[model samples]
Target: MNADGDETPEAAYRLLHERAVGQSPTPGERSLSAAQYDSARADYLAEKRIVAKPGVAIWPPTSQTLMKRLGNGSWSTAMTSLGLTTNSGRTRGTGSFSDDDYRSAVAEFLDAAADGDNRSVTSDSFAQYIVWAKERTAAGAKRPSGAAVRQHFGSWEAAKTAAQA
Candidate 1:
């Protein structure tokens, strides 16, 4: 893990995994805190110099780079390999909501979007709808996120087509 560039990517991932081990956040706290990420970044920079800035993102490039170097696939796949759970709530595969419920939500959002001149249901629009619905809709109803919906249908286009059906 020296700065000599001798440490393998697998070793880097193993280091991150070790840091995350038994680090479950309490209620109201994020799964992975900024401090943890920064700490990892410090260690990462110490070992291999790069231009990754210190901040947050939907998917941090620092993590993505390390994951790619390890030959893992997506972020979720990399996290699974490291035995880490993402901060996102239950995914479609986890049974957070039924398929019908998700399709209904998309259909309703599309109907609203169609009322205006814009009929295109892009990922951005769906994400905004999720935020609006979460604030306005009654409690206890699961609102699928843009990522979740996209993952459910494999793409925004697929989701729109399924919702229309």
Candidate 2:
């Protein structure tokens, strides 16, 4: 029990985990995957971003702290060490993407659009590129979206210019 005495250790851990990941832990003996663990850590860090008090340091919790408090190892090693099962049944992308992937997808999309009847980038071209990029990406790999490309290059014309450059 904490100072408040109402929150049990399990409850406290659940609250933190839920806030960090936007969901509660899965029922039964299951552990998070490496990607999922990384995401949770990121969420925890994002949530912990607050103004520090005078003479008081506010540091985000680390994976080690979570491990110690949760009594479990990382998803990769937990299955062997703790005999826990993974909840991820199907392969899915982590949704974290790289700049290179975005740039490459944009280039590919522009090239395809040029080769097609439309020589210029339009909404249809962007949608086609998104489909092409998703098909080219491997299973469980993050795929680029039209919004991601726009965000990366500021606009479709800018993205086309960058690809040309």
Candidate 3:
């Protein structure tokens, strides 16, 4: 609760976390292949955005898939060189990364986007990230991963350091 009588939102967050990783599968909710789920979720989100009204609707891909897909992409260069993100994707985690950590993590995410994991993201939100990564690649920062870091280390920098060693 804040200084007022309002209840804190931590419970809602906990509930979401619980759902992300639960004990057993529900009746009809069989465990889905992460890739398939991600693809489907991307499609679903696209449908929502495209079918809606108002401004120039664009559903970017989820940062997870996009980051690994792009392969350190331009994020590392941008963050390291300019202390800013070149790609317009989520950089900060749940506030775990320091500024430097933020830069590294952002680099990792762009790396994914360049690689094209298309699977790192949850099935429910992708389109925009995919579109952004691909678009950026077309414009310049052409990065494309042969194999996703997540496929082995579950992310980019992990795969990079592992490959380095």
| TM, every model | 0.52, 0.34, 0.20
Model 2: residue 147 alpha-carbon error in angstroms: 1.5
> In model 1, what lDDT does residue 51 have?
50
Q: Candidates 1 and 2: which is better by lDDT?
A: 1
lDDT of candidate 2 at residue 91, scale 0 to 100: 32
Instruction: Give the per-residue lDDT of model 1 (tens digit) for 1-165.
Output: 534454554445445544565453333333343346547756655666555555733122355565564425345545545455556654425767679977998887777676665444443365666664574355665567767788889988788889999
The top-ranked prediction according to lDDT is 1
Whole-model Cα lDDT of every candidate shown, in order: 0.58, 0.56, 0.38
Global local distance difference test of model 2: 0.56
Candidate structures ordered by lDDT, highest first: 1, 2, 3
True lDDT of residue 84, candidate 1 = 53
lDDT of 2 by residue, 36-132 (tens): 6546556655666654468753333344544554545433334334444666554332346666666666776666666656544443356676666
| Index of the highest-TM-score prediction | 1
Per-residue alpha-carbon lDDT of model 3 for 12-78, expressed as tens digits? 2122223444532333333323343345445655655545346643333333433344434432331
Off by over 4 Å in 2: 1-98, 116-124, 138-143
Instruction: Kindly give the stretch of ten consecutive residues in candidate 1 with the minimal lDDT sum.
Output: 25-34
